[model samples]
Target: MPRIKDLRAYLDALAELGDVRTVDRLVDPHLEVGAIIRRSYETCAPAPLFTNIKGTAPGYRLLGAPGALSSAPGKPLARIALSLGLSADSTAREIIDALAAARTREQIQPVLVDTAPCKQNILLGDEATLDRFPTPLLHEGDGGAYVNTWGTIVARTPDGSFTNWSIARIMMIDGKHMTGLVLHPQHIAQVWQQWADLGEPMPFALVQGGEPALPFISGMPLPNGVEEGGYLGALLGEPLELVQCETVDLQVPASAEIVIEGHLSVERSGVEGPMGEFSGYQPHETSMQPVYTIEAITHRDDPIWPTVVEGEPVDEFHTATGLTLAAEALTQLRAAGLPITTAWEPFEGASHVLVVSVAADWRTALPGVSTGELTQRVNDVIVALRFENLVPRIFVLDDDVDASNVGELMWALATRVHPTGRRIVRTGVILPLLACYTPEQRHTATGDKVTYDALLPAAGKGREPRSSFRFLFPAEVQQQVLENWPN
Candidate 1:
């Protein structure tokens, strides 16, 4: 399959592949839409296209979980692979390897364009009303209807040297107002802080749908000073075509379905929160957050709105957020000259846990490794990275275990890990987003991150070869079962 330019093309491809289904019946944007998408995520079912949204206007539709796991046995993560312009049958390991390789490619900058599809239908100032769209109240417990679940927020430093692209949860405040709650750790918040220091509001543009890679790279934690558009351009093997925003100096994808230009006010603050996060928990309280007032709203003739369902494994959070981050981490570790051969976060872990595999012959990577000092060295390198903030635990595995396979990881965890000496605990600033932490730990923003050694000592009496189903059954016998078992 060719690279998907935007969300609409991906959805159309899903329909043709029988990977998506439409709900002809009316569905409420409140709890109903949430319920359906949640179930779809759990079952790895087809993507749900809600045609009869309760408050949808003509030419507007709601697409739930655009790249959620596919139910197809042959290619469960097929949708996620396609989102990054890979083959439908691409495995998780292949995707990670591809991303790691792309890190070495020269980033191609975006091409400047004028009058994009996103500007086909435009509303400025008072006309930039958000009430007309069917912004879904994803969760019943959510404080308000969220319109920016899967969009990209573009922000630039006050000096104009750095541009950050990220995904932050947003709540609809009114016709032309919205509030976003971003942690100070985010690059966007850092840019906002820089603007606040200058006593000026930050110019911003929110893109609802653009290239399929937009959300992927948005969730990706690229290095500081690097442009996301350029990185994405390299990944796609083509330059991203960008058009200047009407109200903001920054640019948005020309193929974007909806673009909202705004000024993120630093002085003004509003209450925002209690939405379900990828950690599978809701915030207990709401807090005063900066408000982003819309200056202009632009979109195509007929636009499809994309949204993600948080609070579970195998959703957009796990597949897109988890997969992309792991890929970037792999690249980072390699660049740092770590012995890591493969890295992945299992969907079963809700994207919080990381499994890193290195060469089984430890001496090959690190000299004088008998005392386990190299383990701590590699662990330190990973925990110190600014972009690898989501990881709470890193499981160091031997090359024998396939880090990409959840089943293989489970087996290694059960057999290789020890409760005492093999574990290395390092203290660090923990993000409050990690649901595993207690409220006290979250308040302190610090915790002991763990690294478990899942590799056997290279030369030891305890070290022994393992057996499995593949080894027990010869290829001839396996082929006979495949040839005759059905009959």
Candidate 2:
């Protein structure tokens, strides 16, 4: 299937697949829309399209759960798969493998255009107010109505050598002002610091409803200094159409539903967050972050704002990030000459645990290898690659066990991983959002990185797995039973 070029095209495809639900009735952006979207994620329902959002002008709409899992029978990853230009029924492993393969291809730069649909309606200076859009209060205890939950924030280094398209939650402080998370070492924060050092506000463009793959790549953990647009192009097998931002020097996806060109203040005066994050918990504390001043706003005739209520399991962050992180880890591990078969971050783990599938004959390749030695080897590679922090916990399972499936992963951990020496703990930089960390650990950004040797004993010793129907029954008998079963 051809890649979905724009948001509308993707939505139309979703409609055909019965994965999009259009809500025409009036819906409040405060909490009602968020509630529906959250419910959709929990129930694996179709993506919600709120056409009659309250307080927004005519033709303005809001799309919730844009990257959330689908409810289509046996096709939970359909939405994510479609976003990546794959078939609706593509499996998790296929999607991850595709993403990993794309990384090896040459970077396809974006094609700059003279004009785009986002320029159909332009508001400048005083008219460029965020209030014109129905930004939603996604969660009850959220600090404010977030305007850039699923949107990509476009920022470029002053030297123009690199451009970063990242997804950072931006909260609407007022009509013309917003605040967002810009943490250390992040591409955005790195560029922002350079601009701050030069005593100038960092130029930015918030792109909403761009090409279907925009958000997935934006949220991906690509290498430092890599332009997301080029990676997106490589993923799509063609260049992404782009248009220069009106106020900022950056270029945005030409067909974006909404583009807010602004200057991110160097001063960290604005308090941002306490919003519900992907960790499935809402931290009560807020932080001082950089402020964004909206200088210009552009959108399509009838724009659709894509919002991701970032909390709990199986949301956009879980589905998209899980696949992206897995692809990254897999690519890096394989490139380092590791005998890794596949890697996956199950949605049930909320991006906390990385399930790494090693080759079944790893012991044969390295005679009489101990679990601790293999665990150390993997840990060294992860630390050397600077991914130890991102992957807090890792479960090493044999390739025969499907790590993508939550049930299979749980079973492997429960049965294969012994309680004593199987668990390897190492101190390292840790993600603060993980619930396992305390306030002090989060404050210092230090914690234990755990790796569990969930692989079964060597040569299948001390284990019996001839229990399931597929394993117990002969192939002929199984085929006959399946053929005779009523549909």
Candidate 3:
């Protein structure tokens, strides 16, 4: 298998699998391009290649729904899988398992090279312009044009002991200025605050389009102090390559399609968002966030910029981050010694829910614990998990439930989960975008989290197994009927 090194190769891989659709007809970058990507995601249509974007330089192009789910019947996650260098038909479980295993290997530091394609054309200081590349107005309700939905921001500690690569939304504030959030407790913000305390602007670079792994590992919720470069190397079974930035002290992927190097002003702020968030809401959120002043721009000849339509589930946001979230959560649960067979974050949940399976025959969290105790232990750990902040509703299912199947998940929710007996409620930091929170609750930054236990109670008295049409007949009888049925 060829290792994914850049955006063009990944696009070629998508084309090879018959999952890419190109549009040579000019499309406006404002709402027209965003609507097409949105429709493509809602329908599980092919990834789009907008060859001609209106009001931009000829060489600029856009890759819509870059790693969104494929509509291919047997390979819905084909784009995501292929991006990770896995088989086109790889399952969510397989992808998660691979990521979990990769975390255990030794970190492979990225190699620094002197020259890179990203620097083929460099614009310094005043010459560098953010709008020159055509920032897309992703939604009509968006506060401004979004140019960083899928890009990775490079930031590290002042001493450079802990470097972080992360993905965050950025809104264009003219040619030299851009604004984006650094949510409290997130690594990027934590590091930026350190620089703020010292009264020094933090050097930074925004990278768009390099190893599909760039964004994948960037989004993984790994342990604090752990950099993504090593984990990404382990995931790809090779060292990541890097190149020094022209204007910033940090380095970016040598193969990146475009690099925007700048300094995040410590004393500056700008009104950043109100974008259609991943939680499917366009909240009335606009804040004075950190201002990134552009100092240099570099890119390969005719580069492709990637963007995601993030509002709803089954979109690029869900497809790229869903499986990774499940993988990280599953790893945490197993390490904590929970009896979780597997976990799945159904794309329909967006970033709000996680479904985990436990075997029907399994019982007890401790040697002599009661079923209630077992459930409590499981609930306690998940409710307090770091990622649980993003997940407010967790469904603990029996092994028979196909967590990946939306139909099965819905059936499990309907028949087993109840409003009272099986549900436990707790409060956590509820993101403002979740619809469950009223505007008041959203403003308060807290909301209720419900843990729904849909598993069979122990394996004893009054045990009622789930009812499914497939289980209506014995295995042998069903096989005979299928073999002898009239054509």
Choose the strongest candidate by lDDT: 2
lDDT of 3 by residue, 1-487 (tens): 6787888988888887778899899999989999999999888888988889988899788898888888667888888888887888988778888888887778888899999889889999788997679688999888899889889999999988999998888999898989898876678988899999999988999999989878877887777878999888888989989999997789899989999998898864788888987888677778788899999999999989998878877776776677787888778777778777788888888777888787555664445655555566667877655566677788888778888889888988888786678677898787566777778887887988887777666546666754554666778887887789834
Per-structure clash totals for the candidates: 0, 0, 0
Models 1 onward score TM values of: 0.95, 0.97, 0.95
Greater-TM-score candidate between 2 and 3 = 2
Candidate 1 on 1-487: residue-level lDDT in tens?
5688878788877776788888889888878898899898887788888778877776677788887888666888788888889988998888898888888999999898867888888999788988778788888689898889889999999888988889988999987889987676778888999998899999999998878778888988777777788888888899988898887899888889999898898764878987888888787778788899999999987787888879867778887778877888788777877777778888879878988878666577677665256567668777767754577888887778887777878888988888786888877788777888788888888877888877776656577666764545788987888788854
Candidate 2 stretches with Cα past 4 Å from truth are 460-463
Taken over the whole model, the C-alpha lDDT of each candidate is 0.82, 0.87, 0.83
lDDT of candidate model 3 versus the reference? 0.83
Residue 382 displacement in candidate 3 (angstroms): 2.9
